[model samples]
Target: MTQTWLITGASSGLGTALALAALRAGHKVLATARNPTKAAQENPQIEELGGIWISLDVTSPDTAKHVTDAITTAGGTIDVVVNNAGYSLLGSIEDMSENEIETQFSTNVYGPVRILKGILPFMRAQRSGTVVNISSSAGVDGAPSCAMYAGSKFAVEGMSESLSKELQPFGIRVILVEPGYFRTKFFAAFVAPAAGLTEDYVGTPVEAALKAIKAKDGSQEGDPVKAAQRILEVVTSRGLGAGTEGFLRVPLGQDCYNRFQTKIDTLQANLTKMKEIAHSTGFDS
Candidate 1:
């Protein structure tokens, strides 16, 4: 089955990788970024690969309509929509400026939501489509010094999960991807600040987290190409069966897998204790 894909942030990192992978899979891709010229940074060869690049600033409310138009103009109804364009605004809740926090939600949360809002009409009309939203490990298990970033991703996860159930009857599948740290400019580039704190605050726990992030920005072992390949495999190359949930949440990388296990362990440990209060604390119960 040949599927057309509309991918956000296709200029670099996972977006670029996935865009290429989709192309390699013989799928049509409508790739978009804040700046198409900036997207040509690492992969100038992408231009020759039949990947259509379009200008898109997710922060803008009207950007999703532009994205939809690009996708429609390139071909037709988008079979798969990958919401992979997001950045981390690493900072503690208090350490973030007002505008910085707003920017974070604007890009990471609201942008994706509005984009989906624009595309859902098309997908619903098609009666069969998939939406793969790229959330982060920080979104699931939380991490030190990444509270704001994590919150944005958490919002994505929650929305995707609920939408999956809602769209099930409509034959529109929603897949949530939780990726661990990978070698991307995301952590290296400070798109948003950690707030302007005093020099004394530099060595504080929040600052330490920032320092740790700086050190690990490009050190993660996850391969973006491999992750992209896996995504395509799940969505296209392979299938479990008719009416089977192949992967509701695909956790890529060893870090993601391990963190998922750890979260499961914590949940299991608390399960018995949770039963004790389940009935007592709830008025409905």
Candidate 2:
């Protein structure tokens, strides 16, 4: 079946990879970037591969409406929407400035929410669609020096979980993709440092973790191409492992899978430990 896939941040990295993969899989791709002209100049393969490149800044208030209008004007409905645009702020939470924190949330959290709000009406009308929110392993488990980034991703995950339920009746599927460290520019030139540095926390775990992350930037093991292919496989119901339909969250990479299991185990243990107390608090009816 031919599908129309709308992907954000398609200028590079996983976004580009996914766009190309979708194209190769016989799906129409609407690839968006902050600057379409610049993105095209940088990566002409997207256009060459039949992807329609559009200008889109996720942080812009007009972006969602513009995208919705464009699709409507073109007489098209998006079958799959991929929210893949985001960046990380590597530093202590205390070291982050107000603007930096808000920026992270604005791009990583609010941006996707706005996009979904704009697109849901169309999906509801059609009564079938899929939304894939690109999160991170940090969303499942916070890491040192990544409090703000992880918080933003966690927000996405929580929202996606509720949305999956809300849209289920309408036949719209919501998927949260939690990817571990991948061979992408996310950890290279794209990752930003804390704008406001706190001297008091110079020798803390946050500082050490930031240094380690910088050192390990380009050496990540996960391949973006493979990840993109796997996403397409799941979205298309080809059944690569568990189908995307029954799962709300898809943890990519072995590292992410391991961490996800660990988190599940920890949650189960905590629940057992607090079960009696929690049940007692329900009240003495």
The candidate maximizing lDDT is 2
Q: Which candidate number maximizes TM-score?
A: 2
TM-score of each: 0.91, 0.94
**lDDT (tens digit, per residue) of candidate 2 on 1-285:** 889888999999999999999998888898989889999998888888888988788898887798898678656688999999999887877667788888898999999987887788889999999999999999999988888999999999899999999999999998888899899988876455546458876788887887888888889999999999888887877858354579887889998999989999999999999998888876568
Give candidate 2 misplaced runs (Cα > 4 Å). 190-196, 239-244, 282-285
What would the per-residue lDDT of candidate 1 be over residues 1-285, giving only the tens digit for each residue?
Answer: 778898998888899999998888788888888778877665776778787778888899897688678767876688999999888887667668889989989988998887888788888888989999999898789776678888999999898889999988879988888898888887887554644655666677878887888888878788898888888877774643233355588888998899989999999989977888876886673
Q: What is the Cα-based lDDT of residue 93 in candidate 2?
A: 78
Task: State the weakest 10-residue window (summed lDDT) of model 1.
Answer: 237-246
